[model samples]
Target: MNQAVRSEPGPVRQTRFSFGNPPRGSVAVVDTIEGIECCSEAIEDLAENAVHPNPFYEPWCFLPLLGASDRKRRLRLLLVHGTNDDGSGAHDTLIGFFPFEQKLLHPLCPVHCLCPWRDSYRWTLRRTPLLRSGAVANALATLGRWLVAERHAPKILVLDDLPGGSGIIDGVERWRAEDRRLCHVPDMHESHLYRRQTDAEAYFSRVLSGKRRRHLKRLRRLLEDLGPVRVADVDESEDIDRLLNEFIALESSQWKGKIGTSMASMPNGSEIAKAILKEAHRRKRLSLLTLRVGDRLVAARSAFLAHPGCFGFKMAYDEDPVYARCGPGFLLDQEGIVRLHDDGDLLGKDIEWLDSCAVEAAALPLSMRTEPLPLHRYVVAVRGGVSEIVSRRFHRVMQALPWRIRRMSAF
Candidate 1:
């Protein structure tokens, strides 16, 4: 616990919902305001509706949502509800969102999770007509104000928005003037988007070194010598079990993975994959991409349609050292991206990119998502003058160690 950090105001409150404000807790509680339970379902819907091929946030990214709210007593979540305009009526829709309180789980992470002051949690709000700007921002304010009285409060609040909309720029402007105690996270909502000429092509062009291109080109040309090659997308079918099993097999072989290898690295990973496929057909924007040379299927890619954007995942390519010269892995990826670009089903006006990396391909921009999903983390602190001083000294000493040793050392 850090003594320098203190509690701050929560979000704005609205009485119109007819829901009386729940009893405010003395300690921060980060619980779902809305859409937390259905996040994964929402991601699947987005993948099915993407007009252009781009990676959107996946629901699984919010796995921490399943955690207990009080675990991090100092952390709190503020979920702002967006309103949508529909012919039936205007209703609250889960729209653009960003996280409020964030704390680094492991201060020594070598990658994105490394920062000592990582307050930016997963936050999101719908980009479509599903949610309105004023309502969401007001709700966020209400939530912030509610946390003001807590004995232990979050030191920083992370806010994220795509460069353009989400009403975040304006929201931040309003949020700053209201409270000085709450600090904003730097580079909070800056997101990244990668582009290719076509959606069906492999997106790794950015990462493809000149030497890699030369080698890949020569390899492809050699593979072409074998015969005329072809690529295709898998059609929707009730045979999801068959398709998934085949996909897992193809993916494992392509990556030198086996029953006990990476594809099955985590029991939950395979379960999530299977669950996604089983529910794919039910979702309009969700689809999978696969590449084959005649009867031999060399690779497969899965993507979710997030209305204006799509999120691609689980890409695997079979590697037969015998055909190593062909570069089936690269070929499959290229074909998948190209196909996404060409697919008529994924075109729409409000086109946008979501998620930092859809495929995690070297070519992916490795940028943050345009909008941040509202996720929460709990923080606990020591109180009183002596406790505060000791806490500060302890935190400084703790953060000074190498990341690896710190992670393994534990709190």
Candidate 2:
């Protein structure tokens, strides 16, 4: 079993550092939401021009979360800045944004560590830092150097759910090569990713086995027998508020509600969902698909658009026996994938792929219709101290635990 942290730890001490002989860039640590808000404009700029897009990290979604978090006081924001154009000594250009939370290694012990900031809601899937285009290597190097230089810094740094082929892993590897004191240990797993090939018909034919195709067809037929079935996609003219409410209701009527895991059931869960959806809608980066039978909404799925890629966020379906037998969830997923592949005007022509964002076990069915993309969690140890050795040993023990236990211990 994992050690439970009862008392909250103190905030990360704020610090600033300027890198390079002539000072090429600098890193500033902000430990409060208010402090982070002061840099909102720069943060948004960095997000817009980031080498990789992570809608989860965008200010619209992130700020509200930080405001609602119970551990907001323990959160830290690392802002990396580059020198301005006027050749003045001022560092105005925001090159990177990395958010972290300070936590105790164990409740009984005082050893502290830093992990990527995540809400207790567990809604976000990606944790990659926002790095400006053409400055990824410098940003990563500056971050590494700052961490190493901190006198009271935590020995362990944990970054979870970093997608594969995002260039971050390579950058980390190079940083480690340059400094042998940082022990980099990574754990990898695969998630489902859908990349459009030919047309929807041809693509599905190639990915779906004959048996599975027939089974799905049978399910669709069964669903239609109840009432006239139709698929709908949320459009620019649609009422987002009503649709979002319907989604929450439809989702809450199933097992999630009984288990208190549904948005409507959890504390502030519905409000958070609405806020995220609204933000995405306002930015014209939201995609919602629903399946209906004779006016009754059977299933719905939502995704956030980060141009060139989409991240599947959530999905829900009616579980009443009458509709459950028809597999409305799977049907809706098929329809969504079909539309995503065929309807260019709907998701925009720039969209290239969709990440299922489902865990390995939950992604098995999706894997049949999509490619596997590896995702990783990196646990790093900053050497040269007894605390570092303790952190390394702690991780070694944790790694020896069973997968289920390890997952439960993850925070």
Candidate 3:
């Protein structure tokens, strides 16, 4: 509702304004790394201020996805700009950047630009700075308005893997095209959250029950029987290259290797892995950890850190099935968590929490976690009034119908 209009000096003065978009504002789409690199300063600034930062959205990671995107489907890299009216003239400041793929409403449906598409992983959390110092809501509104103008607006825009307390949800609360959370525990989005407490014991107590603690201890003892096991943790950029290769090998040794889907297998997977890890390293946000039995690497955990919070991206183990019986993955996972806690601020960023980024079914080495990471799925419509009154009627009725009857009827 903050639609106050103000005057500007030059080309920006003629820029159209509506909804939360300011009068002196404009929008553009950037679908390439060259474009992103051009705005590196602004993009980096946004990353610094990003809420619940997701490295998947980083330029390097997206390089492959953009390349693999369907030619028929339009890839959108929406950039919102705010015009600053200095006495001399008007200048545009990069206020926001949103990336999404546009596709048909349905395979057979003639409608185009029904909404944005997400990948199979659902790593679509709010990585961009949704909570800017100011103009956050205005930036979103500008994007919304543009979607409407271009007929790219969906009746409902769904966002997957939204984290708890995300600013995106907060920003959309007041929009006529509102945001709503629909929680589901799909393996792709579900992850564990370990927040460090007083000490290791206390933290474990908070996350695990007495019985679970005993179980993990027994598993650790069995694993240690293999050999003298020790954890090596590093937040250093220099170690990422070697650590990355180790992780890929461990990951590929099992099903990932057989299926040729591991980071070391796919065409761009290695490049993406190297690029992201290297970038994360350069930004001083990389964490490479391993659990070794003598000189042999049994398990590896690598991630990208964002100050107090670290997001686990990959957890791989040497697959021998004997180690599986011994719980090698869990052992390393447990050590990695404790390493983050014990090392506390050694790197100047006190590890407060680790988003396990695990599938819900996988039992970690440390069964006792502070909390189950809440993963939320949500849908935001272009025009709330129209969606509620028109588009959602059929869905509402279908939902209301008896589940068994509907399934039997195949409706």
Candidate 4:
């Protein structure tokens, strides 16, 4: 194990270090956004002191899942720093990532944080306040400088949401070609940002236009006949798990007996959904959301809400034969949108239009359309031939597909 310890000059109370060389396998250094020590050390302190539930990236939580794979050479960890640190503590540790593979398939360079948390529709450092610190920025800049000096030649360095302070790194190229902005070292195609106007009323005004919205409204009125008609919007950390299961059930039903794919048809997808929600909730990010109707969970939607935009994740409704015509799924989404507007007022933040990840013309009628996140994939000489070829082919195919199909996909 190799260690690099960094301490503030005057106060010796805090010091940061990289514990081990991941390539060496015995021990690997976890990437800390604050550029401090790996999460293993920081999380220990938080777990011991904090009363709140452990965040998804908490060292004890991720280490076990990642430790075994450290030897594989594919693991890449980025840490998000929390506020507790002397500027060093649990909050001091930011993002942690592990790439599925090390090479980019296309002409572009493929450099992405293996462990990424989505903020807004894209990924960013402030998914949690801890990741938004100056320490994390210093660490990233230092790391980038070191890599450039060492001739690592990474084609791209994808910092999900660019966090803050990403522009200072030397030798890295920054691009803003797609839906969002990304910082990285240059390759064939420079990175680009995704920018689009989200007009919520324009998107959903259509839903309210036709009998579709009216029918659902009437369904609610009729449902009131069963009892008191009510629309409940839930956005709490503790309720994440239950809502997730409800989503899974709805998703599964949607795919039941289908030929190709459905949300519930896939294996372990449920677990993946929960993991993401848990992480997003832990960060207090706006990615997780759920809308329930009286007693029986009716609709569950997971989305990423950024300053000027929101990305819709999975949205499903419990299938009750009796209420099928009511379009529980669509109705819940309508209510969810309204709740978002209300929350925006409550929080005093701008309510940008919701991004459908991809355009679902169906959703367009409801208010969302397709918006793609700019992607700069990098391919290098050292990456295996097979991997590169496959990646390029995949990228090409995806780029060719229409937005609606992509929006329904769970990649």
lDDT of each: 0.42, 0.77, 0.57, 0.40
Q: Write the per-residue lDDT of candidate 4 for residues 1-411, one digit (tens) a residue.
A: 234454443322222233223210111233333232334465545333432112333443243333323344432343323232133443334322222223332323343323233312121212221232233333333343333332333423333222122222211232122212222222222121222224345445633456655676787776555554456444562566776677677666654416424444544444544665566566554453444445666556665544444455566665676655566666665565555555453111454455444332344322422232232223211223433344334445656778764443212
Q: Which candidate is the best by TM-score?
A: 2
Predicted candidate 1 versus true structure: per-residue lDDT over 1-411, tens digit per residue: 111222224332212121124311111233433323434454334334322222223344333322312344322333333232121213333333333334443334221111111112211222221113334344344444533433344422333222344354455556545654443332322234434333323344544556866876787777677666666555564366777787877766644365544444544555655655555445555566665566666666666555555555566666776466577766655444444455453422233443333323444234212223332221222233433343334445556877765664212
Cα lDDT of model 4 overall?
0.40
Q: Estimate each model's TM-score.
A: 0.57, 0.90, 0.76, 0.49
| Regions of candidate 3 where Cα sits further than 4 Å from its true position | 1-25, 31-33, 64-73, 83-91, 108-110, 113-133, 151-156, 176-190, 235-239, 343-348, 365-368, 384-411
lDDT value for model 2: 0.77
Please give the ranking of all candidate structures by TM-score, highest first, separated by commas: 2, 3, 1, 4
| lDDT tens digits by residue: candidate 3, 240-270 | 6777777778888878779876777766567
Question: Lowest summed-lDDT stretch of 10 residues in model 3?
Answer: 179-188
RMSD (CA, Å), each prediction: 9.8, 5.6, 7.0, 10.4
lDDT of 2 by residue, 287-379 (tens): 888899999999998889987888888889899899999999888878876776665656535777888888777843463556777888777
lDDT of 1 at 154: 41
